[model samples]
Target: MARMPLAERRRQLTEAAIRAMTRDGVSRTTTRSIAAEAGVSLSVFHYCFDSKQALLESVLTMITDHYIAVVKEAIRPRATLRETVRAGFQAYWDHVAARPAEHMLTYDLTQYALREPGFEHLARRQYELYCETYAQLLEQLGRQTGFELLVPVPVLARYLAAMTDGVTLNFLVLGDADAAAGILDMVTDHVAGLIRER
Candidate 1:
């Protein structure tokens, strides 16, 4: 057997944790289960993460990073701000549709983190990352389109994050793609309406 590089090993453990949480729910998932899922020993799991809470934090970061990449790739400069914003929203909902399991796991972990003592910071940091990432994206879009948002970039970013969370959660619970698409279109239109051409 060969030793995995440090980064690779960490990624493996994180992925395993995601699977365990998705399969067993966050409350039931354990470090031992995650290690088993990763095909690593308990000692290796301990070496990688001090506690399950630490591992959940890493999972939150990984999930957020993935979402940021997806949105960034989906959105691009377009002829009009409306087109750009609509395209971005469409791309995002498409991603949620494709990976419902991952999204569900994220929501589950969020609840888990919020209820657990000393772990609430992970939930706070997760939303902060979302807000920060969206703020940067909104700034870039404004630069590209010469449009100004009705609200400050940070406020709009937080609003968009909250909107996305609501839409995704609704879709997850309802399992209605058509309804989700309609809601997404409505939300995108409202968001696009917020930007004035400068």
Candidate 2:
């Protein structure tokens, strides 16, 4: 294959960094390791990312984008509200299970963001954006289908999103997908009940 251009190389390096962090946690994904993984020199890594934090922030964004896509793809208009919600949860669970180590990377980046003023703000805004977007989608679906949403769509969406995050964290902490899946089932049932109520 032809050599990748600088722009492509930068993107490749960033993606490789994300993969490394997901596999080994952020602390273990040093600049050297990322450079090695990307088949580039340490100097190239620095040239692309001024600091490790910058690289990590970029990788975090990539991971977040991947996760958001997973959630979006799971929302099928043909499905009932409850099934849509359950499918969303299952998609999230599968995302975690597909690359369990990525959960650690996500948690680590979350913790890392907590310490930085800029990243903290971005994290908060991103989460709020997700809540708003999903809430609106759920509300529209409810209105379109005449489904009795258990809670207002806005609140329900936020709650489900939070539950999804909580489940991911639990799996990361316990290293037990089974336990996480069981808890997810309970959360799913509660969400379904909310929408199913008359």
Local accuracy of candidate 2 as per-residue lDDT tens digits, 1-198: 356677777788888987787777765668899999888889888888887667766776677678767866776655566677677678778888897777677677777667766667656654665577668656655655566775677787787668777878777777887898788878878876776533
Which run of 10 residues does model 2 get worst, by summed lDDT?
Answer: 136-145
- Residue-wise lDDT of candidate 1 within 4-98, one digit each (tens)? 88778889999999888888999998888999999999999898888887788899888878877877776788877677988888878878998
RMSD of each: 1.4, 3.7
Off by over 4 Å in 2: 1-7, 115-154, 193-198
Off by over 4 Å in 1: none
Highest TM-score scorer? 1
TM-score of 1: 0.94
Candidate 2: deviation at residue 36, Å? Answer: 1.8
Which 10 consecutive positions of candidate 1 have the poorest summed lDDT?
74-83
